[model samples]
Target: MNSETTNPKHGALPPWNVDELPAPLPFSLRNALRTIGPGAILLVGAIGMGEWIAGPLFVVQHGRSVLWIATLAFVLQSLLNLEAVRYTLYTGEPVLTGFMRMRPGSKVWGFFYALAGFAQLGMPAAAAGCAGVAFAMLQGRAPTDGDASMVTWITVAIVLVSAVVLASGKKVERLLERLSWMMILFIFSFLLWVNFTFVPLKDWISTSAGFLSFGSIPENVDFVMLAVFAALAGSGGIGNLAIANWFRDKGFGMASKTGNMGGVWSTEQTLAPVGRVFPINAENLKRWRDWWRYAIIDQSGLWMLGCIVGMFLMTNLAASLFQPGMQVSGVAAGVFQAAEMRKLWEGFWYLALMNGFWILFSTTLTNVDVLARVVADMAWAGGAVPKKMPVGRLYGLLLLGFTVIACFGAFLGDAKLLLMILGATAAPITAFSALQILRLNTTLLPPELRPPLWRKIALVLTALFYGAISVAMFHQIFSR
Candidate 1:
């Protein structure tokens, strides 16, 4: 029998090796850290699309008041992400790995994963195609005669870029960090630009809500505005789960399982200093000081949650600048007309805007690629897919196919419709992912590491939030 001392209820504690205790914590001088590596890229990539695109776009369309709603969603999603990361880091396992322990044959779990694969291929393709179009728009050139041609050009770009990128390997972790910082700088610069060019916050928010919404004023609220809020609130925090997985892969996995037969338990209490190849806690304490803490820092969630917070600010900024009378589409993205708005901050920076598009859409391309990889990985796990199958390569190809479909949709000027379709289609998946994560923790984890009472509260909240959003979307999608 294992002899380590541990909290029987929480599985194993972390930050410690199963060996004996070590010397006191060392004080080392470390440089300011950078958000590089998988964590950085994942966060930036997510913010590029989820926040920079989805969140701000919503702000532009809906009034700034919607900021409150989106902010709340970010908080909720962050909590979920943190929880997942904390556990995975402790277990040295992916959240999905735990799902295997959930009584085996859950067709329900398997089915959604399969469906998610399909969606993954499509989403990245679409995002890449959109980015391509944005790129083309910058040069004042159209690749094809119409939108369809434009999408094709974009799809080709995404494929080429991904191929080139994947072929040459700089560590993705470092690459992601650089990209995120660049994006952050860009956003900050844009904020500065907007502050100088636009009206003051007070002036913008004073505008009439003729069709916008407030808690009590039903008279001014429009369905479109409501839809915008719902979508941003629901979809914005998606990256958190990924964050949890990444951190789990970091060092949190072996956390709870480290007890020994010895009498005096030597436990570790903190993270290792940077530049250390491996974390150096020498004792295998059964329970962590903040044992469940890693659940919060997954790759997908870390930057995304922060970005959403940024976006909430953006929405508020816009509301303060041009609320009561502007359509989101018209404000940030009007055609280059010689109107008063075009002369000021409202005027589009075809260059910066186009670059933003590239950054934004490439993530989609990446997203599609990620999804395909995930799907292929899922199949590979089944033992049904051939061991020799180039699943990763196959997934890349699948992404290309999705790009084609997305370009076709974009060409038809139906991108909004596509967004709506994708959003609605993924809602059930989102809900399932949330529920699965929560359930996996509860049912599969050794009771010691299972989610605590507060997490149970969070799980309930996530369910209702997702369920309510899903029901509302279902009504709209099939309503017509």
Candidate 2:
């Protein structure tokens, strides 16, 4: 067969001529460094204002002992993220999709995912709102009443972020990844600097420095406590899974590559003018499965897992730094604001904390949309929505519309008040977790990838962590 006669076509390659190929051994060191991808970007998209504010605040308040709490929180939160990966890898189902696959006869299981997409409608807007406020704060232009409302600034910031994301397409990822790396560097820099510069580091870091025991609490009860916990750990909180599931649903998760059915490309020695021809046989074909492979190759893929832990530690840090007794919302919103815009620009450092807000809330803008999509996906899969409509898109539209209405409602009524006054917002998730555990136990996952014994043990441990937090929250609330 002549090489000139056979050109490339379809998924099939030309016959593998071993004699025509060159021997492999020429990878440049510089070329090898260029292959990273979107994992870090995803982390940046998620680990925002929360870390900058909460993590730093905790460090300031709790002293160095805050490290223990931050570490534990990271581990616990990361385990859930790990579950997100595990659930999505082989099956390609995200949290909402997983909810759809729940047991048929289970008690009230369907409701576990009914409103999953509610966040989609407003998350982007909410995130933008926060980012704008943070951005203003960072720029030393913290909004005061008549100068410029927080709402307007947030709206503008969100629009800008969205425009950037939309315009950049794939390129936005590279920028995001770079920024997230910077955030990590910032955290480490502070950690290192604090470790060295602070004089009390040795004395404070000792074993005698202990956690507040239950007995340390005054033997008192407060009724409003449970609601605080409910607010903290509500349905919209476990967003790690919601966003991750989105990436999975988008085909970023592990996939088993079906074997190549065409002629294989083989390497071999070749003559000068004429390229050689080789055999076309079953042996030449290759089959490859891409399951769990995303973990290795995709840069933006697994990086979110690490960031989730970072954010969790950040939460603990915040709590440690600024627990109730030490401060109660008195952190001035306009600490260094000048009436003039010129002064704001002159004080660039004022905007340092703005990135923190940008980090969490910027990504939150699109998150609710993904959540809405997830809910729709689950709804369609469960037959709650008509098949003709393609539930995901239909529900996404509905969720979007509803969010618009909700935002309007925010003007009419107190959005924050409306959000908390509703219910034990986490009930849907608690239900889902229970069902997920049961499903895992009853052989839902493949045997080989079924959670190991330690993971199984961790299920209870994780649940207890949540429970303990809940109880502690209630105790604190009622005692107050």
Candidate 3:
């Protein structure tokens, strides 16, 4: 393969040298494991409050019949996420940056995208708030009744600590990448162990059937059902778009050529151009094919696998431990679930409780960083910010601003309400992203690099699936 490197003199730091036709290393399962960073980070951000809080809430109330939603949603989101990574691999641009370059004007789309993102500001705040509640419960305090001020203060403290960690140095991304894998190995594994050990065989069989069988939504749908459906259909919220930035930062495939944004404390920053198109050729095509295979292993093995397993295990746990019509709310769902486990094994409750706390706290950290990176990227790409503005400064500003906003949201102290609001706003954006990916793959990408007919059809169906959910959600809102 012919390799071409370019070191353009621009920005505060040296530009990343572009490596056209950079050869992909020979793929192996072992190498795949070593390269699994970005997707695991995505999983860490994706699982968060939605999978743990909203997902289990649905199963606990609505039964395993709703798990089909999670299964179908996972398949659709996998397709969507893979396609987003495809754009990043070819053009060395983040997905939102690519979306900004689409259509009449990048600025116009960026505006709407930013607005959609703003609506999701409540997510991290809500998650941090839930984490505080979980932490309080572990300390023998009632999350709902005892020491209300303690939960609020704990929530604020979590957000502040996350910001400090993110701003610590340029190594923030690597730290989070490692942290995500550790959570997967320990916290996630513990949850799965509890599910298998406690969940009855009958509940397991029923949940499996619910996953495999095409189940119908009950005629009488409520706001809770709508919220869970939207949240479980994809990663929690706007955080899904941030995966492209994570992949770029991790130097995955062609993204290695692009300049990465520095951490909040970094002195120098580089703003990579969004639409720096590369020409297609035989050598480039070969490299693209190899990179595509690498992308599959990165996403399928880590991101999708973690989300599917985590969601399934949590849902089964909820279904087995709680009866239908039980009025569980917020982080309390986890507390109650853990308390139930105490009956089976000594000290199991503490394990479950700690796992629950980590789930929310880790997700809070990931969400804060992802949101800051994505917003900074969007602003820079769309020319909303001055060219000379340091990426790290913008990232810190956005991170702190969002954290402040989230503290107010935490004061509301209702995790389910916050999730419902986030879900409703996210549905349309999810559909928009799916549609944009389809458009980009077909119109912008070269024929050789374009998705195959089957894949294109799947993208179309994915768009329609989310579109239908969005429409139904809006209709429900209006009718009520």
CA error at residue 288 for candidate 2, angstroms: 11
TM-scores, all candidates, are: 0.70, 0.59, 0.91
The sequence of per-residue lDDT tens digits that candidate 1 reaches over residues 328-415 is 3211121211122334543354543554564555465345434444443334334435544443344445445654554454443333
Window of ten residues with lowest summed lDDT in model 3: 5-14
Badly placed stretches (over 4 Å) of model 3 are 1-19, 123-129, 132-135, 145-147, 274-276, 331-334
Q: What lDDT score belongs to each candidate, Candidate 1 first? A: 0.44, 0.38, 0.71
Task: Tell me how candidate 1 scores on lDDT.
Answer: 0.44
Model 3 lDDT per residue over 243-289, tens place:
77877777666666666787777767554654343446677777777
Clashes of each: 56, 32, 0
Give the alpha carbon lDDT tens digit for every residue of 1-480 in model 2.
Answer: 333224311011112223121111123333223333334444544444224333333334434343344334334444554555555443444544454444452223445454533532343334433533464565455444343344444544554454344334222233334555675556445433333432243433341232221122223322122322222221223454454444443333331111100111112111011112212222211101122343333322345344444444443333332333342121222121112222335443333344345444444434434444455445544556554553333543545464554444334312122223221233234324633653543344434445676766665565665555456655654766
Q: Which residue runs does candidate 1 get wrong by more than 4 Å?
A: 1-39, 103-108, 124-129, 132-148, 170-174, 196-199, 203-240, 248-282, 285-305, 320-342, 345-348, 386-413
All predictions: root-mean-square deviation over Cα? Answer: 8.7, 12.4, 4.1
